[model samples]
Target: MRALARLAVTTLLVAAPLTAVTAAASAVADPTPITVLTSDFEDGTVQGWAGRSAETLAPSTTVAHGGTGSLSVSGRTATWQGPSLDVLDTFVKGTAYTISVWVRTASGSDNARLSVERRTGGVAAYDQVAGNTAVTSGGWTNLTGRYTLATDVEFLRIYVETASTTGAFFIDDVTASYVPALPIQTDIPSVKDVVTEFPVGAAITGAETVTEHGQLLAKHFASVTPGNALKWDATEPSENTFTYTQADPLIAWAKAHGTAVRGHTLVWHNQTPAWVFLGADGQPMTATAEDKELLLGRLENHIRNVAGHYGDDIGVWDVVNEVIDESQADGMRRSTWFTVTGLDYIRTAFRVAREVLPAATLCINDYNTNVAAKRDALFALVSQLRTEGVPVDCVGHQMHINVSWPSVADTRAMLQKFVPLGVEQQITEMDVSIYTGSGESFPAPPADRLLQQAYVYRDMFALFREFAGEITSVTLWGLADDNTWLDTFPVTRKDAPLLFDTVLQAKSAYWGVVDPSKIEQTPPGTSGCAVTYRVTGSWTGGFQGEVKVANTGTTAWTGWTLTWAFTGGQTVTQLWNGTVAQSGTAVTVTNTSWNGAVAGGGSATAGFLGSWTGGNPAPTAFTVNGTACTVL
Candidate 1:
């Protein structure tokens, strides 16, 4: 459902975000030191380790993350061929645990990932938690992750799998034990309801497959941008053949849901049909007036057909996307449109859009405007178009950010810089990345980093709130962790960039934007409502949990809101089918109108995924309708 063909910005403009993390060897946390289930392999032996793939394994003293010995694998080229261990009878089920490995490559860039999984029969077969870290040629990197176990798995595999381009590697200091999850702060408000100056939204594609994703969009977002359907390729797959099949449903749904639609990209360098830029003979457009006129006419016709059809339904249209390429000294990308029609192509595209939807906002969108040089070049182009009397209404900075770099301060400066142009600004495709900018996946961002991401989010929203006069809208690229494109970009890796977790639950970062303070930093406990916390699954750096709510009182609870907090820095990434949020350690879970009525003995349940540091502690307290449950 998502547009898989957007311009790749990291490859063209390699701006390394600030990374203060260390790759030096470090000690791993032993959360359950009293009842350690596994060995760290400090002894020079492979007694507890085995390889599932065809790999030679032996104990090595060459390098280790913590101790003296390490598991060495050689003659392996596949990335998924490193290590495996059975945990069926040795590990406890329904508890959070982690595996930390210090690893380095023998000759490769980096190629080892630790995975723990269980296999059930049929459709439920082969589920696991996987987390990895990048290793330099000569340095050792520590990788860690937390996951939960739901059932008594008879066949479980704890393995370090290498990628396709793997060589020999050494792994050491592996530890897996139950770590108590910290209770999260859960008393904060939702970012969408709190920020009113600009409507909040996310780009969605086929939210049908995941029911929770659609529910989150319906509850939190006021606008919708079909990431790919509205593009020329999806809307007009064949020349002169406009198919609203992919787009019509989204628009109709938006109108019915009281959500506005933002038309994504009437004109763009990518996703445009080849025929639009091809001549009658099916070749490149010539510099002749015919080719120029042909391309210009096609551009105008496309704008009229699309913008004119939707008209006011599309509150704003990305008239042009990614025209400024920073690879060139002047920061202008060379494309067929620019070649055939010169710079007038952009101006003409905007003119036609303005003519069709005069009242709708027309925006020129691009990625990587957070970088100063590219930002300046973008301003230069927009300034030129404005000086020429083009009908450009707003500027879109695709704020795909990282936790360490492009600090919110820098982003605000860029937004403020465009205010003088008299055009409004919108963070068009905003998703903050968690990768540490080395083009390689670092271990899952630790809790502190996630909190730091929350602070950055607050600063960003604060900037937006401060500049409410100039900022019109702020759209998160995607709503949930699993719906984003950050995982498939310049370097393929798992990244938590959005406010909601992969499980569709809110993160601490969500609180940073809503109201940072006032969220109590304490673990959850039973206050006024009977709340039951269950460990469904946990592995690597994350875990899945379920909460059951029961009235367990004489009165029937209606319109109930359950609240709890975590002691550790554990965060909820995704919450299944229910509305949930976090402040610090407090977790507030509210039911839909359908499920709000819990009778004197009835219950409701909601599930979520969480990330933890030293421990994963279940909430001890919960309150429903301002009454503390008696169970805690």
Candidate 2:
């Protein structure tokens, strides 16, 4: 069994020497930062430092990166069991910070990371502040990077740790400085002014209603969609009772600003209350006829109350969301609604929404419609329901794409395939990610990846304009990179996928939509590979680790082999997604038949469960197909 504990330590009132650094120039100019923390550990105390999990923390006189001493952390059983600092009051919302910390192993070498654990809406998210840097006993390594706290949270703590090594490490000269947000340009052309055929919009929350964010939102976007305020759980938490507390202010804000609102959605598989799926007997309802009738009745009541409350304030409604799964035999998601009422839940949703709103455009929405399989499945379901006289007025394609995927041809095909069905199309919940795969994470958005993202936005907007007559509305998933859902989804890391940056300043992505000439050509990735090693989980004597091999080159990589050496006596007892060969401390991994091909800027991941003895120090170097790879 695993154990959990939090180390208790005292705060030091004395300050240490501060280091001055220059901030990088961008579209907006940032103010000079002010130092907030400076801990040199010269006070001979381990103050304000605590172990993140079950670990021992103390002041050590054995080694010093600066004056006379450094804080020592040891007796760790997990990768996350390391020294941490609580900065709940030290951080300010809507401001960026530059963090710096020096670390080195006590005996062996390991890859150390500087990160923060933040809680928003009761969900915890970990954001890496710096790239994983290799540290050894020979010298001190500085882990320095920048992070923006876009939103206010209930808890915030910064920590230092290794990937999978359970060895001791020393920390010194820690600092946290505050960097003010730059000013947004008002002289720029409004994005909605460039488009004439359809409305240009963005998704927002209460945070967007004040300050520069409010000004930017009202300026560029002609339409608005509440990110999560109108979901079933928010609107109705109990039977026959409904509340618009979360959604009303946003709707009112939109109306006050003359911004059109899109009601999303009437039904969905996620963010739904558990009580909705429970029977009168207080248990989950099955596929009985009685259960079917009860479920459909609840769905109908929900639509009438929720949609009717909004009335004409919202001109378009996503009647049902993400209901098509190509992997399923019936081309339908096995949600509670589907399991209980089959297709009837969908039919009833559109029917009830139409009856309540009458003139509002009712749409069925799903993600990854750019793929042929999911697109075909959505087409089949929409055609069947529309043929049965259901008011499926529009097809909403959630173009949540990445910078390197779903070529222009495939997106064109997606739009053209639905054109033959004579249904209006809308690009809903659109955002372009910088990373191509889930295993890839970055401390900050790479300049090259941002350039690629701008080109994607430019190309995609051009495509949407070509189908001006068929597509009626376009909405980005978020207004800015500050509070995107992608920050927490898939994996907890920073993602800048929207047109605006964290400071409410327009990025190259905004220019890609308004004016393409401003977007520069993207430079190809360097001719090398970048490997990332992460410990997914760990126990007493064994742990699970994953290695991501990224093709950081301009050309595609086919049939490659990755090799690395381990400093610690660790053995890979089981591995998947690749074939592994181990000899002493040297190990080689080859791609399987299915995952051998990797595109430029894309990545593939392989995981293993292993046992270790003495110390589990991470490898410092790796090579892919005889080419040296930069360990991240």
Best by lDDT: 2
lDDT of 2 at 375: 93
List the pairs of residues colliding in candidate 2: none
Backbone collision count in every prediction? 63, 0
Q: Assess candidate 1 and give its TM-score to the true structure.
A: 0.56
lDDT of 2 by residue, 356-467 (tens): 9999999999888989999999999999998999999999988888899999999999999999889999998899987788897654465578888999999999999999
Candidate 2 residue 398 C-alpha distance from true site, Å: 0.4
TM-score against truth, every candidate: 0.56, 0.63
Worst 10 residues of 2 by lDDT: 1-10
lDDT digits (tens) for residues 391-468 of candidate 1: 889999888777877876687779888988999898888877876675545323334456667877878888888999
What CA RMSD would you report for each candidate? 15.8, 13.0
